[model samples]
Structures are given as C-alpha cells and as structure tokens.
Target: MGEATDRSGGRDRFLDRLPWLLRWAVVGSACLLIVAAGVYVLARIAALLAPLTIALAATLFLAALLDPVANWLRRHRTPPALAALATLLLLLGLLVGAIVLVWRLTADQFSDLAKQLDQGLTRTRDFLTSALPISPGQLDEWTRRAVSGLRSSAPDPVTGAATVAEAAGALLLVLVLLFFLLKDGRPMWHWVLGRTSDRSRPMATHAGGAGWRTLGAYTRGTVMIAAIDAIGIGIALVILGVPLALPLAVITFLGGFVPIIGATVAGSVAVLVGLAAKGPTTALLVAAAVIAVQQLEGNLLEPLIMKRQVRLHPVVVLVAVTAGTLLGGIAGAFVSVPITAVVYNVLRTISEDRRAGAHAPTGAPADPPSRSGPGDATGVAGS
Candidate 1:
C-alpha cells in the first residue's frame, strides 16, 4: 500500500512538471490511430476505386477544356444542356475519327513496320558489335534472355482481358461525368461553397475559382504546345523521308501530354524509324531535330506559357511527375503537373488571404467582393 501511494505521488509529480504533455500525448495518439485507419481504408479501396479515380480525373480535365466553350454557347442563347451535349458529341466525333485514322494507318503499314523493326535491330546490333567490345553472340544471348524474361513476366490472358474491360469502363465513366460537369459545374461549385461556414465561404469560393482557372489555363496552354510539337516534328520527319511519319507524329502529340519523358520516348521512336529506313546519317539528323525541337519547347514554349500560366517551379513539376507515376503510372504522370499547379495556386491564394486578414486593422472594412468581367481572364482573374 505504501509503495502504491509513492508511485501515484511520483506520477502526479511528473504530470505537474509537464502539465500539457499528457493532453498532447492523448491527442497525438488519437490522431495517429485515425490516420492509420484512414490509410488502411484507402489501401483496401485502392484497386477497386482506381478506374473510378482515373475517370474522375479525366472528367476534370475535359471539364477544364470544354467549360469555356460551353459557357460561350450559353452566352449566345443556347441552353446549358444543349451546349454541353453538343460539345460532347463534337469531341466524341473527333476522337472516333482520330482513332479510325490511326487504325487505318497502322493496319496498312504494320507489315512494313515489322520489317523496319527487324532491320533496325540488325543495324543496331552490328553497330554495337563494331563500336563496343561486345560480341554478337553475347548480344544475342542478352536479347534472348530479355525476351524470355518479358514473356515470363507478362500477365496472363484473363488478367489482360480484365484490364482492357476496366479501361473501357473507365472511359465510359469519364464521358458521363464530363457531360454533367460541363453543364452544371458552376452550380455545383456554388453549392459546395454554400456548405461552408459564412466566414470561410469567401475563402473557399476564391480558392475554387482560382484552382479552376489555373486548371483551364494549363489545359489550353498544354494543348497548344503539344500541337506545335506534333506539327513541327511531323513536318521534320516527312522532310527527312522517314517511314511512319504520320504515326510517329501522332505518337508525339499524344506523348506531349506526359511532359519530359513522353516526348523523349516518342522522339526516340522517330530516330529509330529514321535509322531503320535511311541509315545512320538520316537517323543522326532526325535525332538532332528532335533534340532541337524539345530544347525550344523546354526553353521557349514552357517558359513563356506554362511559367506564366501555372507559376510552378521546374523542380516541383519534376517531383510531382515522379510521385504521380509511382502512385498511378502513366495516367497519373499525365495529370500530375496540372493538378500540382492548381493546388499550388489554391494554397498560395489562401496563404495570401490569411496574411492580408492578419495584417488588416481590426475595425477596417473588408475588401470588396470580386466580380466577373471582361478583364476577368480565366487563370489570372483571381489574383
């Protein structure tokens, strides 16, 4: 009994010495448990929700791209639903046409492409044999092993079929979500703001508006940059008499959505095609052209467009891309930068507002409400 009393007294003394420690300890433990539970739930839902998440992301991107056009139609006396439907139909038609074109091109040239690939491999092997200290036998052995490994590592037929089905479902989901978002996005946003506390409602509105504008600007600017890249590279490949110029150009265009790595992969294919059809000299020239175009894009186009539009640092973009790829593969990489830009802008705006509020005189009148006007350009309007 005496020892139990002494221990209780000691515990009280410790608590007195660090009066807030127990309270903080309890709070921290609760937070940790909550976080752990959340993470577990997320992990469980990850695979099931992956396609849905991708669809949602695609919908957001499409919404950003088409919202302005829909709004324009609305201003011209078109009903919102009609405007959205029309936009969706037009985009769908274009997408179908593009797919048909690609399919036709591929079907017509597949045999030739196969031959070119064989010849390209042969040429590459020969060049490596002569330039490097590697023997032809060793190279052949390595190639055989790599091929065998790939075959062994590939998913089974059932798994592949399931993946295809999932992708199709996701695409359909995106289309459905995009139509609604384009038609009712503004109302939906206002509704969300309505749910916030009165003091925070303005901040939420400002943040959402700023984020939407950033996303829109990023999408538009990226499309422009990608189009320029495709046109320039396609023209270059055609002038160089490279085989599969159109296909390669289409690839570059699609790849431009993925930023640094995407362009490089597409350009490498162009160089390989050039080498396969026209030999080393032509291949070298094609490579040089690709490099030059990419450099111009990185230094001129991105700096002039994305820098002003997104205001993201290069390092931040790189890290975001890397993290996104690790988390969600190619789709993640494609959307990562734009999402980062939106989040960055939202956070910055909120931070600035908080600072302004803190610095304002206690009795001063609040700033006037922001208005939409001609000067209210998409991304820059919030600032």
Candidate 2:
C-alpha cells in the first residue's frame, strides 16, 4: 500500500508538470501563429483598402459624431432618415454661412496681402542688390530660373487629374456612408449580434453599448470643446483687430478639431497674422492669449466634459496620439482618441462584469473555464 501511494503521488507530479509543459508549448505556438496571421491580414487589408481608407475613416467619424443629433431628432418625432438629412442640411447651411461671411470680411485683407507681397518682393530685391555681390541682372536671371524650375517640378497633369478624381470619389464615399450609417446604425449592430452565437450575444451587447456610449460622449465633448475654443479665439482675434479675423477664427475652430497639435498650428497662424497686420507687441499678446485659452480648454474644460466619457490616463492618450500620428498622419491623429475611448470602455465593461460576477452569491470565481491542471487547482484552492 505504501509503494502504491508513492507511485500515485509520482504519477500526479508528472501529470502536473506535463500540463504546464503542454500549456507553455501551446501558448508560445499560438502567439507566433497569431502574430504571423495578423501581419498577413494587415498587409492584405492595406493593399485592398488603401484607396478608400481615408474616405472610410472620415465617413465613420462623421457617422459617430452625427449619431447623437440623429438620436435627438428621433426623440423629437423625426424619422431616422429624415433626422439624418436634416442634420446634414443644418451642418451644410452652417458651413456655407461661415464660408460666405469669412470671404466677405476677408476680401480687403486679401487685397492688402497682394500689395504687401509685391512690396516685400521689391524690398527683398533692393536689399539683395545693396548687400549681395550679385548684380541686379544676375538676381533677375536667378529668379527666373527658380520660377522655371518650380514650374517644371510641378505635378504632371495626369497625376493631378488622378489625385482630384480620387479626392472627389473619397468625398462621395464618405457622404454616402454617413447617410447609411446614421440611418441604420442600430439595425447594423443588431445584425452583427445576430451573426454571432447566442452565448456571445450578451457580452457583445454590453461591449457594443459601452463602445457606442463612449464614442458618442467623446464626439459630442470634442465638438463642444472645439466650438468653445474657436469662439474664444475668434473673439480675442477680433478684439485685437487682427486682419482676416473671421477666416482666422474659422481656421482656429477647424484646427481645434484636430486635437492637441492642430490647436497649436492654428494659434501659430493667428500669431503670424498678428505679426503681419499689427506688430510684435500684438503678436506677443496673441500668442499669450492662445496659451491661456489652450490651458483653460485642456485643464478645465476637457476634464469636466470628458470625466465620464471613457476616462483615459494622460499617458494613454499621449501614447495613442503618438501611435496614431506615426501610422496615418493627420487622419490617424483625429481617429486615435475615439479608438482609444472605445477600447478603454470595452475593456472596462468586461472587467466590471468579471468583478461583479466574482462578487456574486455563487461561490465560483468569475474566470473562464480553465484548460490548465495543477495551476488552476492551486488558484481555486487559494481562492
């Protein structure tokens, strides 16, 4: 009996080690396979979707942003299709109005700019004649040569036409996609769930709901912040007597939509306008005003607005933005925040569900069924 007990204990020890050895081997192999497959899939997708990727991305963003308006309209006795159309029309009208207003206001500034450019060129020529070793004839020849070089290096007509066609196609795709997404978003979600297994439906629903809420919150909060930033900057520019103030304000507002980096670029433009139109002192004041406004938006406004809408750590946001810039340049930068929000919300929802399950009356822990042997036994025992 003692010998039999020893043999059984020895068998159990071997069984324990065997499972672990298999687990590690399986895990390592699976990880390698997954990495390889991911690379292959990503390469395939990039090749297939390179042409339409930008437009698709823009469409998705617009759909996400406009979804709340559509929902609000639905609540107010508007059908989904009509609500989407109405929202689109309202947005279009606002854009048209702003464009017209800015153009009318800035016509004088543009005329002045043309005169200023001519004066600057003359001054540059005079300065070069006085200071440089080259003769005026040589300078003129050099200028002509530079102009010829630039004209020669300009994009070919064929390439330019192709680019224009692509841009137009992209715009059309985005508008079409936005309309359908706004109209049938809920049905689309339901359809996705229907395609999945019943066992996964509840988790899918939770994840989808959480993701949509996070996206909606992010989109609405961003628009609000952008509007506030634009209004504050526009008022300041106008008060400071900045030339082309309306256009500058529109630029500032649009730049705010690009997030941290866009605002800085817009502010730089404001300062440049201040420098050109006003003077160094006014430019300095404009720069200071921009810094103050950005501080307010970043510290006070953003935190307050985004508190409940997928709260990411500053580090996470910075990292995501960096990765986004690296991957898709400006478009990546614009989409990264909402993508981070969705990912954070989904993970958070899953984690919360697990925690709640663990704390439920049932004694079993809220972990997936274990495929391991002694490790799982040890874990259960410890619990």
Candidate 3:
C-alpha cells in the first residue's frame, strides 16, 4: 500500500508540474493529432472508393458552376427535371463542341507535332554538343539506350484497357450524379440543414453557404485565370512564330487546373518548342514571356478576380497538392487545394458565428438571413 501510494503520488506530481499554458499546449497538440488521424482514415476510405469519390467531388464543382443556370431556367417556368436536364445537355454540348473545335483546328498540325518534335530534338542535340563539353557519340549512345530500355519493357495491354475502362465508367457516373444534383440540389442542401439540431441549424446553414460560395468562386476564378494564361502563352508563341501554338495553349489551359506543377510544365513545353524550332535566343524570349505572364497572374489577376475569396498560401497549396497526389494520384492533386479551402472556410464561418453568438448582449440573430445575390452563391442554390 505504501509503495503504491508513493508511485501514485509521483505520477500526480509529474502531471502537476506542467504549467497551465503547457498543459493547454499539450491538449491542443493532442487535438491536432486526433484531427490528423481522422484525416488519414478518411483519405484511406476515399482511396478505396476512388471512382465514386472523384466523381462526387467533380460533380460538386460542376453543380456549383451550372446550378445557377438550372435555377434561372426554373424561374422561367421550366420544370425542375427539365431545367436540370437542359443544363446538363448544355454542359455536354459545350464540352463536345470544344473537343470538336480543337480537333478540327489542330488535326493537320498534330500530325506534324511528332515530326516537329523530332526535328526540335535534333537541333537541341546539335546545340547541346556545340555549347557543352558533351560528345555527339555520348548523346547518341544515351538516347539509344533509353529507347532500347523502353522497347524492352512494353506495358501490358490488359492494364491499359482496364485503366481506360475505369475512366469511362467514372465519366458516366459523373453525368448521372450531376443530373440528380442539379435537379434536387437545393432540396438536398435544405434536407441536410434540417437534419441538424434547431440550435445549430442557423450556424450550419451559414457555414454551408460560405463553403459553397468558396467552391463556386474557386472553380469560376480558376477557369478564368487558366483561360488568361492560355491566351497569354498562345499569343507569345504566335509572336515567336512557334508552330503548335494552339495545342500549346490548350495544354496551358488544362495545366492551369493543376496549379504550380501544371504551369511549370506548360512553360517548359513552350520553351522547349521555341528552342527546338527557333533558336536559343527565341527560347530565352519564350522563357521571359512565361515568367512575366505567371508573375502577372500571381500578383494582379488572382487578387482582382478572386477578391481575396479562395486564398491559400503557397506553402499550404504545395503541401495539399503533395498530400493529394500521394493519395489520389492526378485527381487527388486537382481536388486537394479546393477541398482544403472549402474546409477552412466552413470552419472559419462556424467559429465566427459561434463567437458572435457568445458575445451578443441580448436576443440577437447569430447569423443573418441569406440573400440571393452574387454574394449568396453556394455549392447548391434555389431559384
């Protein structure tokens, strides 16, 4: 009994020796660990449901973009189902139109892309041999070895077929999910809000609204920003007399969806094309153009267009992208940042609402009633 008492006393003192602030810090750290663990588990579950997970996330963004159009049609006396279907068809039409347009414009040029790239490589090799200490034989030997290795290790046709089939299935699923979401998104959102306690309903509604707005703004702003990048780069390529400018522009537009890595890749392609087809001077010029355009995007376009709405620090964006890529591959990297931004926004809204509620002197509304305006956009909205 004496020994047990002494050991218990020692443990008590050990805990007691921690200062109040230190105890709080330890508790906070533990809470963070709990959150991290929860996130890890959720990510694993998401990976297991990769196709469904990706389809859902993609559909939310699509819903946010097209929900307003559906709503507008409904206001004009279109049935909910009709509005949703029409909006979905419009989206499909736009996608198909863009693909067809791009194909027609670049069909002949694409045939030359391989030949042009090869020619570019030959020129690059010559330039490298002249500019560097490397011998032509050494370069040729390296290229030959790389090609031999690639040819020796052919990819499995079955694996390729399976991957393509999986992608097609996911695309079909998105279309089905998107129509339902568009048709009944507002009711779904309201139903979710109703599920919460009366005490928490206002807060839930407000936070959900903020999250939806953040997503909508992020998607729309990203599209516009990416378009600007594609235009800027395409114009530069055209000015430099670079062939495949349209293809490069399309690549840039797509890359814009991927953030930092995407921009770097798009810029690198432009520079390489310029270097191969033109010369070192044109390549240098192309590089300068890329730098200027990217800088303008980072400084001018983002702030003005996004209006400080969907902001994330560069480090946060990088880390989110890395984590996402590790978990979900390309799709993970694409959705990670937006997810982070939305989560942050919703939590912030909740925190702010809670604080306002606590500080109210008397009977006061914790959250103001939502209005239907540009300021009132969400992931889903009613007419």
Using TM-score as the measure, the top candidate is 3
* Candidate 3 pairs with clashing backbones: 212-379
Number of clashes in model 1?
A: 0
Reference-based TM-score, model 3: 0.89
The parts of candidate 2 lying over 4 Å away from their true place are: 1-48, 116-156, 363-383
Q: What digit string (tens of lDDT, one per residue) describes model 2 on residues 1-383?
A: 99999999998887677878797897899999997698567645754676587777677667666766776787788877888788777767987897888788888788787665465466667766887798999999999999999999999999999989988888878777777777676666666778979756555666666676676677778888888888888888889977777788778887876667789999999887776566566778999989999999998998898757566776877787776776667766777778888888778776776666667677664543222211121111110
Most accurate candidate by lDDT: 3
The residue-by-residue lDDT of candidate 1 on 265-306, one tens digit each, is 999989988887777888999999999898998888877876
lDDT of candidate 3?
0.84
Off by over 4 Å in 3: 1-14, 20-22, 145-154, 362-383
- lDDT tens digits, residues 1-383, model 3? 99999999999899899898998999999999999999999999999998899999989889878877987898789988999999999999999998898788778777777877788778889999999999999999998999999987866899879989999999999999999988877777777877889988777777887888888888888889999999999999999988778888989998888878889989999898889877778899999999999999989998888747598888999999999999889888899989999999889877887787887778766545442322233346443
What is candidate 1's CA lDDT for residue 32?
A: 100
